[model samples]
Target: MKDFLAELIEIPGGSGYEEQAAELIAKEFSRLCDQVHTDSFYNVYGIKRGSVSLESGERPKVMLAAHMDEIALMVKDIDEKGFLRFTSIGGVDQRILLAQEVTVHGREKLYGIVSTVPPHLQDAGEAQKVIKMKDMCIDVGLPPDRVKKLVRVGDLITFRSPLATMQGSMVNGKSIDDRASVVMLAEVMRELDRLQYAAEVYCVATVQEEVGTRGAVISTYKVQPDIGIAIDVTHGETPDAPKEDTYAMDKGIAICKGPNMHPGLTEKLIETAREYGIEYQISVAPGPTGTDARSMQISRSGVPTILLELPLRYMHTTVETLNLDHIKSGARLLALFIASLKEGWQEWLKY
Candidate 1:
């Protein structure tokens, strides 16, 4: 898991540029499925056929989606000091911006650090102010002319934090927010390969989710599955965060209930988790979930969807964290839930 995640996190896939990770996931999925197809939008769809085909009695079609994009910085302007000023690709916290090291994508990778005025320069009272984007500048160890030669507008910048082990079971890294979700889908693929299922499964590694969930919106319309499951990260609050609003890290996965999710599917997911002896928690989101499920639920024909969340703390920041055991449980729970989708899932939904 760490090896696969290392390759994914090392790739510079900010919002719109998820092609590299998408291709890697597609290659793995194609090896396991009967037919693999990629749409015009570049959402990769791989299918594992059911025991009952279209010729036989109908079977529900299920689609499982995970996004490939990770939050990052895009080079907007490079100043004389060789510092890169940029905008964020997704929702990010300004609090974590100070003194963080980053990798700038060029023909050759350049290492830099987000820096600010030294403490010696700032008045002691003024130092209490929180760091903002404008106050931060990247310092690549190069002279102005050489920096200009290597870096340019639209170059990628990513947080340079490595996968960190917290406590015994908890892990922290750069893109665990969604790579954990991708890993969940990978586990599902492996499970289905090991066991027989009665429903057609279309598993996708969706692109552009951090930006607008454009990938799931486009791909779900194409696959038009009877049921959709969107996997992504949610809140895992630490001592500094709001306790009532978040779950504990390394405890369990979260089952979402909200307007964006189908309640019946959520109930079924909870049941499956319990039956499989996988620990899980309940999460409630009143409106748009900020997840791929929101995009898919409103797709053509209005597909029913549910969201399975891997609780991650400090999301969109340099040190996003989660538990590997929770992720593994999420994968098992999803596979068990999908495999239990009865032949009449579509018919059952008609009421």
Candidate 2:
């Protein structure tokens, strides 16, 4: 799990440019799924057939979607001095952009560093404020002519941060927000290989979620499954974060409850967790969550949906942190729930 996640996080799959990550996930799923394919939009679908067919002469379709795209930068322009100006591709916090190493995916992969005015040259009161992203430039250590020759306008730029193992089972790296959940999909598939499930599972690695959940919108429509479980990341507890808003790391998966999530499915998930002694925390969302669940719920005639969140710190940054054990536990919970979906299980989705 650790090595797989490490390799996944290192791959650059920013929003609207998820082909590389999609290729890797499709390859991995090919071994686990009965049919694995990438759609036109780069959403990787891995289907596992079920043992039991329903009275309707069809097995229930369960869609498990996790976004593969991460927050990234796009080169909006290049100045005369080989400096690259950029705009955020997703929800990027400008405060973290200073002096970060990045990879410019232009004509060729070029290494660069996000650079700005040094403190020594800063005007009075300049050091007290965060540097705006527009003021920062990616210096590729090349002259103007070479930079223009290599990098063009509208090229993608991804953080070059590598995954680092922390004390115990904790690991921190880039793109852990949804990529970690992607790993959770793998774990669930692995566990299901040993269990007998009745629902045909669609493990979808969705694209362009960070931008606006566009991938979820299209993929859910395509799958049109009976149930949709959107796995994502939530705010993890930090020293200065509010206890009401953040969950503790290393505790368990956070199962969300609210209007966006189906009540019956949420109850079943909780009950399954209790029955299996799987540790889990409850999160209350009064309205729509900022996850694929929201989009999934409104797709087609409206599929019964739920959201499972892995606690993560420093979201939208390169060093998003999470507990690997939580992923394992979440996978077990999901697999057990899927296994419980026997004949006439559609009744469980009713309000």
Candidate 3:
């Protein structure tokens, strides 16, 4: 899982540009699933057939969605000095942009560093102010004519930080937001390979989730699954953050509950966790979860949906952190929930 995650995070798959990451996900799923394919929107789907008899009516289709896109930047303009000005592809914080190493996906992979006015050059009060994205530029060390020839105004840029293992089983790097969840889904697929199940599992690596839940909306309509589960990241407990607002790290997976999720399905997930003795934390999402689950719930007469999250610290930054143990636990919980689905499971989805 660590090695796979390391490779997965290195691929630059910003919201609208996810072909490279989607292809990699599809290839991994091909090894574990009976059939795999990518849709027109670049959403990758891998199907694991159920062992139930054809006489048992159509097997319930279960869709497990994990977005492959991450927060990134796009070149919005180029200065006369050959520096690149960029805009956020997703919800990026301007506070972390200074001196960050990034790779510009232009005509070629160009290395660069995000730059701003150094503190020594700032005015007395200006030094304390936050640098907005509009005022920042990337130094790619190229001449204006040379840069214009190789890079365009709409090139993608991604953090160049490599995943590093920290003490206490924690891994840190960029894109752990959804890539960690993606790895958890992969682990679930591997677990299902050895377990008996009766539902058609559609493992989907969705695209454009950061910009909106567009990928999930289209993918759900295509699969038309009886159930949908969105795997994402939530806030992890940090020293400065309120304890009540964050989840415990390395302890368990967070099972979300509230308007966006089907209450019955959420209950079933909690019950399954208890039955299997898997540790889990409850997350109260009173409104749209800002995840694929939000869009998935309204798909085609409403699909029963649930959201599962892995606790992450320093989200949307290059040094996002996650514990491997929590990922394993999340995968086991999902695999158990899927394996526990039996005949008449649809009836349980009713309010």
Candidate 4:
């Protein structure tokens, strides 16, 4: 799982440009699922048929979703000096742009470093102010003519940070916010491959989640599943962050509860976790979760949805961090829940 996640994080799949990551995910799913396909929106779906026969004449369809897109940049302009000005593709915090290494996906892969005015060269007041993304530029070390020929406006850019394992099972890299969850879904698929399950599982790797849950919105409509579970990342505990606002990194997976999620599905997930001795944390989302769950909930006549989150630190930054154990535990919980689905699982949706 670590090696797979490492390879996934290294790929540049920023927002709408998720074909590469989607293809990789589809390849892995093909090995574990009975069927695999990619939609026009690049949302990859892998179906694992259920072994259990039901009198209802129809097996429940369960959607397991993890977004594949990450926060990135798009080249908005090329200056006369050959510097590239860009805009955020998602919810990017402008404060981390200075001096960061990034790869520009233009005519070809070009390496560059985010540039900012040196502190010594800036005025006293300017040094104290946070540098906005508009003021930041990428220096590709190419002349104006050459840069224009290689890089055009609207080219995607991603952080060039590679995944690094820490002392224990912790790993850090860009895009761990969602990629960690994607890896967890893959683990769930692997577990299901060996188990007899009642519901037809659709493991979906959704795209364009960072820009909005556009991929989930469309994919859910296409699959029209009975239940949807969105795997995502939440804030992890950090020394500087408030303890109440973050979850412990290596403790357990977070099962979210709130208006955006279905009450019955949330309860079933909690029960499944406890029955299987799977460690889990309770997270509260007062309104829409800003995840695929929100979109899935309102799809068609409405789909019952649940949101599971892995604790991650430094989200949307180049050094996003998470614990490997959390991924494993989350996958186990999801697999058990899916396996626990019965012939009359739809009856359990009653509020």
Clash number for every model? Answer: 0, 0, 0, 0
Q: Predicted candidate 1: what Cα RMSD to the true structure?
A: 2.0
Please write out the lDDT profile of model 4 over residues 1-351, one tens digit for every residue: 999999999999999999999999999988888999999989999998888888887788999899999999999999999999999999999988899999999999999999877778988799778888888899999999999999999999999998998879898999997988888888998888777888999999999999889999999999999999999999999999988779998779999999999999899999999998988999899999989998999999999999999999998999999999998888888888998888788787888
Please name the candidate that would achieve the greatest lDDT relative to the true structure: 2
User: Ten residues in a row with the worst lDDT in model 4?
Assistant: 341-350
- Superposed model 4: Cα runs more than 4 Å off: none
Across 1-351, the per-residue lDDT of candidate 1 in tens digits comes to 656776776676777777777788778777778888877666778788766444446788899998888888888899987878887888777778778888888667999988877888988787788878865788889998888999998988888877877887777878877988887777887777666577888888888888889888888988899898899999897888887779877668888888888877777788888887889888889998888999889898798899989888888877788888886778778878877866556644542
What TM-score quantifies how close candidate 1 is to the native fold?
0.93
Please give the RMSD to the true structure for each candidate, in Å: 2.0, 1.0, 1.1, 1.0
* Candidate number with the higher lDDT (1 or 2): 2
Of the two candidates 3 and 4, the one with more favorable lDDT, higher being better, is 4
For model 3, what is the C-alpha lDDT against the true structure?
A: 0.91
Q: Write the residue-wise lDDT of candidate 3 on 1-351 in tens digits.
A: 999899999999999899999888888888888999998778999899867654557677899999999999999999999999999998999999999999999888999999867778888899778878998999998999989998999999998888999999899999998989888888999888778888899999999999998899899999999999999999999999988879999679999999999999899999999998999999989998999999999999999999999999999999999999988889999988988888778777999
lDDT of 2 by residue, 13-91 (tens): 9999999999999988898889997999999999998776667776779999999999999999999898999999989
Q: What TM-score would every model get versus the actual structure?
A: 0.93, 0.98, 0.98, 0.98
